[model samples]
Target chain A: MKELWELFSVFFRIGAFTFGGGYAMLPIIQREVVEKRGWASDEEVIDYYAIGQSTPGIIAVNTATFIGYKKKGLIGAIFATLGMISPSLVIITIIASSFMHFKDNQTVQHAFAGIRVAVVALVVNAVVRMWKKSVKDLVGIILFILAFLVIAFTRISPIIIIFVSAATGILLSYRGAVKE
Target chain B: MIYLYLYFEYFKIGLFAIGGGLATIPFLQELIQKYGWVTSQELVDMIAISESTPGPIGVNMATYVGFQTAGIGGAVIATLGLVTPSVIVIVIIAHYFMRFAEEPLVKAGFYGLRPAVTGLIAAAGFEVARVSLFNLQEYLDTRKILDIFDLKAIVLFGILMFVTNKYKKHPIIYLIAAGVVGVIFKFG
Candidate 1:
């Protein structure tokens, strides 16, 4: 019971504070779960992230579920998942109720205009950081460019892109192994 | 009936919205077209609020849409439906594939997926930039080249980029600064 409460509180704090979503939540997750709680090792957290991204659902929630299950079990997963989403539930509800009242306010409009542009910069920063970490070799570069162009230009689904890239990776690695 | 519909629709979104939070945008767009639950303009506003909020954009969006369509109960139900797949899948992976990462094929999959995810994120960034920095629809209507560029927004973006790279502060700081500037200059 105590452990479940702890899990909820830790993830609740993480969910409440982190601003930019999956990638931005990493540092806080590392701090609370890895360093402070010793729930999982650094490498394990990275693995969880990789798996979380590859799996269906939001990466942040998926990661919380993985770590929670690792610590306790099904019950732990429930508690952690609840904790992670609770903040969004509360905050968004408040905003939704209030936003209608101020939706057309001139000051609010100006603030959102600024906020939107700032968000663009933030997303661009995330891209640069992700690029350095993920795009390592020639094959990676090609995949990155191809995925970007397809997603930007066409109506093709990203799910298809992810599956095709995974297949390509397997085939490429298999051929390289044969050559060696 | 509405509750069931919310649960079913969001369940599908959770099942398929791989990559991350921003990936759900396309799905939400489809929902708008199909259900007319919210207008396209409202969707844009929701995205703005989601980006600036505390939690994952996907969860925030689910809450927003649910609240719009129904009420607080709807919000809770929608959120639960969206996360149900994730909870089930993660638990299954934990129970069945304890050593999943050690598998060579899984490693290979990640090797390919990393770059692909990067590209997806880049595309998302581009889409956000398109809406925030340019008035494409306005330009198309006016047929004016200068009307295409939001010059003030571009300037603000450049300045924020410089500050972010140099200072490395928490993102909220930049967001607040931008909001202040926007209020003063009446950006919109």
Candidate 2:
């Protein structure tokens, strides 16, 4: 029960603090869950993200759920997932009720603009870190370049690229080209 | 009953919406078109607001729609419905992932997956950088290369890039500092 509450609060902080969603949440999760709590490993977080990105629902929510379940099973999953959504529920409901006009507020707009820019740096840092660790071989380099281009230039779903990359890995291992 | 119905719809969305927050957009568009949930213009507005907010964009949208439809209770239910699938699916997947972690096929798949995830995130970073640093519309209107640059934003981005690499501080500190600077500079 104590661990479950810890999961809830940790995820609550993650959901509340991180803006510019999607990849922006990655570094925060890494620091909070992996570094602080020792709840998950760096490799495990990456795996959760890989699975989270490919699966259904929001990646952020999916990640919290996976980590929560890993630590304490079904109830832990519920608490963490709830914690993840709590801020959104409160903030959005409050805004919807009376502060919808805040959308046009200049101060709020400027702050978000700054947050967005800083978010770029965050994502870049994490990407650079992962690149060093993950992109070690030629196949890794090729897959990295191809995935980057396909995602950046084309309209293909990331899921398809992920599947193709997985198939490439499997086929290479089977052919004695790469050892996993 | 209406709340339950709305919640069920969100549950279906959760079940089928692959990828992540942005992936839920198409389904949202369909809902707006089919049921006039919030109108096309409102959906666009919601998207803009949702993107800048602190939570998952999809969850924010769901809450907004729920609030508009049935107030706070609706918002809570819709949010719950959206995440329910994730908890169920991930729990099931984790169960199997652990069981299969040792299989060569799984390891090989992971070898590919890790890099691809990094690649996808790099692409996402490029997108955030484009939004934060470039003035696409201004460049289009002026037809000048220099018009594309937001000099202030670029300066902030550069400073942040340097400092973040040097200090290795928690992201929250950088976020707070940048937000304060943005407000002071009137980034808009």
Q: Which candidate is the best by TM-score?
A: 2
Predicted candidate 2 versus true structure: per-residue lDDT over B118-176, tens digit per residue: 89888888888888899999999999999899999999999999999999898888888
DockQ, computed on Cα atoms, for candidate 2: 0.81
How much is A118 displaced in model 1, in angstroms?
Answer: 2.6
Strongest candidate by DockQ: 2
Q: For candidate 2, give the lDDT of residue A44.
A: 82
Compute the lDDT for candidate 1: 0.83
What is the fnat score of candidate 1? Answer: 0.76
Model 2 clashing-pair count: 0
RMSD of each: 4.7, 1.3
Q: In candidate 2, which residue ranges exceed 4 Å CA deviation? A: none
* Model 1: lDDT of residue B60: 95
Residue pairs that clash (backbone atoms under 3 angstroms), model 2: none
Off by over 4 Å in 1: A1-54, A67-76, A177-180, B1-13, B16-58, B68-70, B94-98
* Residue-by-residue lDDT tens digits, candidate 1, A75-125: 999999999999999999998999865566788778767876787787677
